[model samples]
Target chain A: MQVVALSCGNGGKEAQDFIHKVFMPHLQGFLTAEGEDAGVFEARGALALSTDSFVVDPPIFKGGDIGKLCVCGSANDVAMQGAHPEYLSVGFILEEGLEVALLQEILASMQAQLRLGGLKLLSLDTKVVPKGCVDQIFINTTALGPVLYPHLSAKNLKEGQVIIVSGAIGTHGAVLFSQRAEIQLDTPLVSDCQQLYPLLEPVFQSGCKLHALRDATRGGLASVLHEWAQSSGVGIEVEEDCIPILEGVRGVCEILGLEPFMLANEGVCVLCVEAKDARQVCALLQEGGAKKACVIGEVVAGRGVTLKTPWGSKRPLDILEGELLPRIC
Target chain B: MQVVALSCGNGGKEAQDFIHKVFMPHLQGFLTAEGEDAGVFEARGALALSTDSFVVDPPIFKGGDIGKLCVCGSANDVAMQGAHPEYLSVGFILEEGLEVALLQEILASMQAQLRLGGLKLLSLDTKVVPKGCVDQIFINTTALGPVLYPHLSAKNLKEGQVIIVSGAIGTHGAVLFSQRAEIQLDTPLVSDCQQLYPLLEPVFQSGCKLHALRDATRGGLASVLHEWAQSSGVGIEVEEDCIPILEGVRGVCEILGLEPFMLANEGVCVLCVEAKDARQVCALLQEGGAKKACVIGEVVAGRGVTLKTPWGSKRPLDILEGELLPRIC
Candidate 1:
């Protein structure tokens, strides 16, 4: 038989690369999602679970890949259901002739990041395809865990509330583009990709009325914000200056003719809160490890999301089409 | 771009066959796994899950593939942990210029069988590839479902319990050859590919002190049996004749230079039993959906599985070596 170049799937080098380059740096705290022989996950009380598969290509980028993206992606889904991320079972589908060393690197990175994010991976399964038959690799991460707020739901996004962001936007997208093109930035750019459990804990424990919490993934903040606005049947308003943006990232965006507002940010989140305590809630979030936290926007009387520009002019923000950086992960 | 020629991945058919006739029959359930609008999967419970892939052509023959073998090949995997097969998600990776109708027929046939087994199908995802990249269409099915017995745990298997199986031996392998070429047989060959759960409920409810239950897939019964023997640190003995085998399947196995004992069975199981309650427990399983159920084996004083033959000879059943039917599903 012809030994066409191919890579073995499951816990190999390419998968491992996916972990370190995109997933590890963005997360923090204890418990590992990447390193152990197996992940230790549990839910003593009632649990909520979700699993997702990422076939997004160029497997690794500055922000994330099918690997880490698969992790946070599943975790976030559970969190939306008011459940904390606990255990995750990862399954891999790799094309043959893949880089083994790259796979090991990704695993090491996943192990480290999961540990930092304080997640325990419960189980793992893998499969390999012949080269040319698959798009490098695909990841299916299934999660299991107990619900934090028993009756809490994403449906809790009340009409009268404020919206907040934990950190800056577009850093992940910018870093990924710069890295992929091998286009060096004047100042090195790194993705802002991260896990949210650590920061959310304080909010959850503080008993603050967390009306809504969501991480801007595809379609960025614009799409999710629009979705919330439509679902809540209320309008949202945000000041351009209030949103955080790193200088280095802004330079890359300008050079590439990209808009930060439309770019993806894996580790960033948007939280809606009650009107009365919005400021106080924002302060608590910033103090509780949300280094770049700020009141990015607010819930208004009308429907849809609007942006207040530097000149005080307003325009509706829209979800840009296609990927900002195809497979920016 | 130049188009490439492709043979029907499913048991080669003439190029002039009707499109729907080739692929439609392969569609399995209500939500077809083939020819659909990007598989629509509904979530009844959070745990709806499914899995399917092709082990056809060179992947079969040596061991298993397509048709008769695919049933237990993937479905039993879901059953191992006791998850009820609810919805199956199917996908096809076809070589370029492939016959669309050919692929459709395979899906239709699968859907019919799944419907027969009461398996719901959620959606289908499909992709096209240029020829030489892949041999033929590789169908991958993913199933979804709510856990039937959330409390069904392997922990129920005790040290002193017995094990049992529903029906006859390897019919899957026999059918593959019977369909491939003309062969001498006492009668028509058949494959015993059926869901194990239909016959499992009564056993679970009856209090047969079952120590563990494992559905044999990849390596066959001996492999899984050996897993129990070593993991549970128990011994097992089975009388050859007590294990059922259809006459036609046995005849085909004898002529094709194959071993029915070692080949895979889509609908069968080998059980371990305690010395005291073997017959009573077997009777319970037989009365349940498993009318042909039999006590094929027992846990012995020593470790490992021993096969007792009519000639008073005993031998060890082992796992397969290397690749048994390269892509046998």
Candidate 2:
């Protein structure tokens, strides 16, 4: 089987041949500037630029791979700023002796995600390190897009703003944790890794005033809430039973003693809108295929996040404090 | 000494503490968007976007480290496109056991470079992998700049154009190779790693109608010439004696059986200008501190690069065919 060699990343004939023969075919139409040191494009407005590096172990996960996660993660970050992602700059660090077929599969996955999000690949770079210098692969993607709605800051959250979650949380984190720990479940669990722009586009178009928007990524839903509470100096009160968690994911969380709220979610986004527009925004997200979209909490005139248990007890929801999982993306 | 722990990158309270206590102090004023997922900025006119991942082994070398190289390399790529780098999005992938003090030093280096280049840190992401998953650290920098001079491309090279090198070649590659191979040299060698924008700014202001501009990185002088020749379908003939090589670097190259032309340079740039403007461009670069700036070759009506020896023999210079030195950048 063909595998990547150190020479492929040497920036010589071998590197050129590798790019042309292996990468270009999969990303032919999306790449705007293939050979230039940098890609030049026209930009004339307020732009949101976000970057993320994906180092998920077992690069190929249940429902997605590192390639898709890299693209989706950055795109979602940009989209959370109420922007329409338009371009991407990606850098790939590969380990020598990695299977060429696996690399191709990842590239193809990235291409598919780019097409889905209507983002053009503006610039790309690839480097190969010796075996064991890096995990199988690590991808860093920087995304840029024009802002459709301005002033979507966590500081904009006011008391009485409703918090809505686009979908079930913790699936992505649960799937990766299970895969790494070799834990099997009665029901298969897939990551909720996907682009968020398409789902959020209609809300932006509806002219709804979004106080704050954030994808519950690394530190998950609880982290986003805590940040919003701290940044806006407001209290976030959520009903524990109202937050959606998949059955299998809940089982995994129970088995692993992981809090579902603290687990990562690539496709789930937390939104804060005025109470008056809460239902409308949730409806728009649901129409955009976020079937589980619903309002779960509200911004109150206090500090920190509080969870109201179904059994009539309230507890503070602090940010994640320890390492839950490494390289969960 | 405190070292990077897996929890520091978990995007939780510890991650926040790490950023606020460690990273933010070093990068206080330069970071535009500290807490936001992505930074929002106004960009107008044509823009150049470039990305590069620096995995230079040892992380720290004689004259520079991965932090400085990451900043300079991406900024130089944008500058080569006749753009003034204005913003950067950096992603740091750190190993679990990396020394926090070393990371602080690297961040300081990055801040220094950013200040030197007059660039702002727009967005940043940090991820920590488990031990052995990554070599100490790898940094990915994505640079964005406004295009000051448009239409500078490798395809713009034409017959009769003269090639001007900003400085000596092969120092970076030689330094890295010697360090990795543990070769003892009588004379110490340092990498020629610096921001090229400052040196080339005067040339852009001169309005010399530059045909092409490229940093002689990765595969070095020979690779740049080969790319230009193939892209513009012209022949480049260089006088061997005209190409500048530091004495210490030349000795290292001879001992290692490596061609200096194929070695990498971080700070050096190769510019293609009209024959009439070659001397003026060289003067401007020399005035800007590239004291070794000189004309090394000229474009001709043929294909590939030819090296004319001082002994009166001509030989073709091919693109680097194999791995000369990995992670030289």
Question: Which candidate leads the pack in lDDT?
Answer: 2
**TM-score list, all predictions:** 0.70, 0.99
Model 2, residue pairs in steric clash:
none
- Model 2, range B262-313, lDDT digits (tens) per residue? 9999999999999999989998998999999999989999898999999989
Give lDDT tens digits, candidate 2, residues A20-120.
99999888789988789999999989999998999998899899999999999999999988889899999999999999999999999998998888889
Candidate 1 local lDDT, A29-87, one digit each (tens): 33332332222222245555554455444567655555677677666656654567776
State how far residue B175 of model 1 sits from its true place (Å).
Answer: 6.6
Model 2 chain B poorest 10 in a row by lDDT: B178-187
Model 2 CA deviation exceeding 4 Å by range: A181-186, B184-186
lDDT of each: 0.57, 0.92
Q: Which stretches of candidate 1 lie over 4 Å from their true place?
A: A1-46, A63-67, A150-159, A181-187, A323-329, B1-163, B169-195, B245-270, B309-311, B326-329
True contacts kept of 1: 0.02
State how far residue B220 of model 1 sits from its true place (Å): 1.6
- TM-score of predicted chain A against the true chain A, for each candidate: 0.81, 0.98
> Evaluated with DockQ, which candidate comes out highest?
2
Two-chain complex of model 2, DockQ on C-alpha atoms against the true structure = 0.89
